[model samples]
Target: MLKRVFQALSGARPGEQLPVLLSFMALLCLLLSYYLVKPLRDSMFLSYYQASDLAYMAIVVTVSSLVVIKFFNHWVGRIPRYRLMSITYAVMMICKLLFLLILPISGRWGTVVFYLWASVYFTLVLSILWGVINTIFSARQAERSFGFVALGATLGNISGAKLSAWLAGSAFKDWALLLSIGAMSAALGLILLAVQIASRDPETARKQSGTAALHVSRGMQDIVSLFGNGYVRGIALMVFTLALISMAVQFQAYGQIDRNTAATVYGEEFAWFDPPGQHFEVIYGLKKLDAAAQQARLKALGRSGNLPTAQIQELSQSFGRYQKQFESRTRKVLSDVYAYQGLLGVFLLVVVARFLFRFVGLRYTVLILPAFYALAAMVLMFPLEIALIQVLLVIGGALNYSLNNATKELLYTPTSEAVRFQLKPLIEGPVMRLGDVTASLLQIGISTALALWLALTEMSQGRLLLALGLLFIAAWMLAIWATGRRYDQAQQADPPRQELDLHA
Candidate 1:
């Protein structure tokens, strides 16, 4: 029964199941560890920096990724695979612990460093982890097992997001402790992964014995060599385009989060729930009133009775003066709510991805991902209620975890192992980060151009964001088409060993 289930899930034979399971667990722990602190990272960055500055921060991440990857290459050659993996895990834990200490004392500067560190850790750690997986399995084994192993990442995302949300809601909401928990989880997972690698594949230890260090100079050469290859360039472009849309969607979600927090902050001071003339006397009055119930409260507050201009002005001034104390609580609640909803979306990805991969080929199923972004952008481009905006963001995020992540990994299978080892890091790291930088610059440029037009001609930022989203989505679609075509050609030229019949 276990063999049958493993066959259905990963197309792996009974002999391969243990290694696949180990790979899955390793990824699950790694992603969960990162995501545990992810919400806090988002909140911190937005709190300290403007939304527009995200692009600039992404550029920093790009540079940091390059540096780390170079460092990774150097170490991979000198250390045993298991020992290096252990060291990698230890370094990540130390960084997380340091972040816990710094977050309390260093203020915004800590946030800035945390943001950069998290980006580097996320990029480098995942790259190294995947590289390890590739090293352990033959290309044929990877083709069969990677899809199932990749599911662990999705599961990890859900587990971590849910854990973080729960912590956020709890009274003893010490972020420092939460981060410590995540770091520890990562360490435990990595240690187990090391044991599994050492025990199962002693040959890997032999391969690592005397490999030369990957020099920093060679990193740039690897990147340049990739762009020079048409096939690799196509893969890079696909990643680049997808990254643009993903980052843009994230930016908008952050925008929504910021807007929600701002509303919560000033909801007491401003008549946000009702028309300008009709105001709730207290926060409870606003909080308790459902749409239908609000009418009765408005009437009780003398909605029909015209207040003098001076009284209205005084009421507005008095509002939020005492209520400022509660703003932290409100923001925390809002952030947690969104975080929970995001967790739900990730959970949904687990279900949706299984169905897609089962029924549709990897090549075709991923095409659906860009459609999700397109539809989301089209719907959200116009004026939308906050509730609807949150819903759309959830849907987009679900699609991201479901199709985007899995499909991207599968694309690597048709390529040579050298490409898988060297070029993939370049693609996933710098090229992907380059896309983010492009998106960020574009976002800033479009917003600035629109703002100037708005001063002269009354265009809204919402419509501008939507327009930019559509533009990027179009590019994303083209990229999907191009990459899909190229991938099909590549597969036909060099088919996967033990390839499952898509029709079956």
Candidate 2:
């Protein structure tokens, strides 16, 4: 019975009736958005925010939807099909304008605010968009075509990132607002989608339309109950772990690139340190004294009266020179890292991702990514090339993402109809965001402390980096073990429980 139910869900029109236009529109909107966001983000169109703000926005949406605003979702579902989709798309348009234009113009909101706007728009609309698709397509179609649908988004992402890269450091920087206008292009595609969907034939017109809709329809209540157990918790935690690795790896890649590439652009070492003006003031951080103070501090290095006056002066000059060299090298390394991991990485990510999910299942497959990440970090520590870190980022930037996203959807498979739609945001969005925030907090703190430690101590540079790498590896392995053990029991079949296993 369950098998038959899934069969009914696999096609746009029960595999009998095809959507001539709506399908195309859906694919178009997804691709357009995917292609634009990357470049917009990396561009000077709105240079004020970081990725965390985006995560925060998503969290806010999820929390609101889960508690105070959940009713809105039902209201959306309650609408007549035509009107329902119209409203969501209309909302999407409003939100997109706000996302693309507002921040670039106002320029007053702090980085956090900017981040929030990006995040909120991304989560709300994207979530709604998918929800609409889920409602429209049969369950089996939901599973298979969802990836194809997502592929549109994926292509958009790659295109956007490439565009941003191609335009980097160009005279077009001043025309950011004009560039912002490009996002409005989504409107055109969306409008096209509406028309196509409106024109598509209704299910009654198709053969086999009377087939069973799907299996194991349950309400949100039972889904919540399932999540209350350890197995579910383990699965959720797997997602959380994956997100952290992705984030940390990105940062690591960025830092490395900035460090290595600074040399090529600004000249050897200390090139990234900037014009040497601010010695005490930090931006988005702490304030310090000016360059004179910095120079004084450098001068004072030999004030311990251990070395001769001539030696001290020589050492100070040499130290400054060394610093500049370091910065230069750092910048070159980082920029290259970004180009490699952030750009070329998409296909690689998809390939490995599909392979793992196809063969290993979401649960077991998820674990292997971190091990790879740990290994990558370990390898980079040995030589510390910026490019190597970018490669590690494949695991760091994409691993958690690839694994967590797959796991969340997998985890929801056996859910009843109501629960599948209703609770997806809470479990996948808010919790996911919270995990991101916490991981960012931990990573920022650890990175800072390590920076300070590295600054003050005289430890071997290679050894210090290696030690940090080891620490991350240890943490990852520990999480993998614990999560596996917790969910171990769920893997086995039980009488009624088998019916509810996410594997289904």
The most accurate candidate by TM-score is: 1
Model 2 lDDT at residue 296: 69
Residues 112-144 of candidate 2 have per-residue lDDT tens digits of 354444444455445444444444443333334
Give candidate 2's TM-score. 0.58
In candidate 1, what are the lDDT values of residues 93-123, reduced to their tens digit?
A: 8777777777867856787898888776776
Task: Provide the lowest-lDDT 10-residue window in model 1.
Answer: 495-504
Give candidate 1 regions above 4 Å deviation.
Answer: 74-82, 138-144, 175-219, 265-360, 453-459, 465-472, 479-482, 489-504
TM-score of 1: 0.74
Candidate 1: clashing pairs of residues: none
